[model samples]
Target: MYLSYEETKDIAYYMCDRTQRLTLPMLVNLLLDVSEKQSDSLERGEAYIRDRGLNWIILHYAFDIGRMPRLNERVYIETFATEYNKLFTYRTFIVRDSNRTELIKVETTFALLDSKKRKMARIPEDIVAPYKAEYSKRIRRNKKPDEVNSEEYNEKQYAVRYFDIDGNNHVNNSHYINWILDSLDSTFLLDHDITRGVITFNKEVSENQLVFSQSSIREEEGLNSDHIIKTEDTVHCSATFTWDKVKRRNMNGYDQ
Candidate 1:
């Protein structure tokens, strides 16, 4: 079964850049919100799973942008439970304009966490049943982010701010997008728009911790970066990012 929601990207929030369209982080945040809402409606949401002493966290995410909507433009986002394994829940999304043209499509993998035990856990059948999940794969399976262990890679450090933490006391995925994008040069950020991104979460980071976000221009592959959230020996979390040439819209932009 599929569930959906609709909203217009707020202009107020985009005063800087992407003022006419949803920024990468904003788009990601919206996707996560829609996913959570669908799970809640299916009785497999955060609170529901938390009650059972288990929770779900995104393990991998990949999305392709076709056309980004501009300010005040209405969008319809629909989400579906594609599949699940003993350890991961698979889901997908379709984002379109009011006229019904697809703007973006995304596939994500989420893993069950034993919140109390603080380790990995198998998903319970009850929750899986509610999503009507299957075993089929939709998009390409997410790969471990490519490594950029070269001396040429540029590194930037960030301080974990109070607002960056989510209810789970860990950094929100949207903020990770922010940090990853920030590693780029201002000229690159303004000139080339991101067409695709694949990120994987490795661990968790808490408040006040320092993180190192490293980037290397895969001039051949846009920008690639790895994020490390830590200050000590323990690596809280890391992510990989890949950017591509942006694709703009046409007269029949919503047709896709």
Candidate 2:
């Protein structure tokens, strides 16, 4: 049976936005941090994986949000690897308030890359055994987001910074969300809250590279945004964000 790891954290001011609610990028970072803590506790952290010439890579993320935690609010985060096939592993993360009301649920897919070959490698038993993740023959496929039509969307350029690279020698996954969200107009971002999101990373972006962030908004049925990140003509990432308009009176309470 697979086991779960959990931790408690308080939303700090640095993790909040102008509305004093937790930012999506920070929330994602925190969730991954809990998973890292668990790996360290099991003595299977970055060092162990590095010694084996393997590096973990995130392929996709899906998020469902009930509400964003407020600054200084305490919350519980729990994570566990549900199952793994030959190439991919599925993981789940849940965040809840002090009263145990769930705030968000994040489903992610990860894979291992052979450092020397720079290609995907099979899931080795030793690495996942510590987490007790169940083995499976089935490969889960998530719905892919629509591609961004550059001519129809707004685009912005960002230079890859030194801090964007992680231990995996690629841009940190969380920064992709930052670039996506930043592509939107500040007024639109401030007036809305992300209720759901789907993101997929297709290629890695290295430091000093210039990438374009593009976005197109839709509101006929409901508020939604499609985004893409690319360098020149090469697409690197794609994502979709569903949002809820914030009512000023209920902003603090996050009542929908």
Q: Cα deviation in Å at residue 129, candidate 2?
A: 1.4
- Candidate 1 matches the true fold with a TM-score of 0.83
Residues 75-183, candidate 1: write the lDDT tens digits.
8887887777778877888888888899898888888888878788977788788777775434346766666566777777888898997866557888877777787
Candidate 2 achieves a global lDDT of: 0.89
- Candidate 1: deviation at residue 7, Å? 7.2
Candidate-wise lDDT, in order: 0.70, 0.89
Backbone clashes in model 1: 2
Q: What is the total number of backbone clashes in candidate 2? A: 0
Each candidate structure's TM-score, on Cα atoms with residue i matched to residue i, is: 0.83, 0.94
TM-score, cand. 2: 0.94
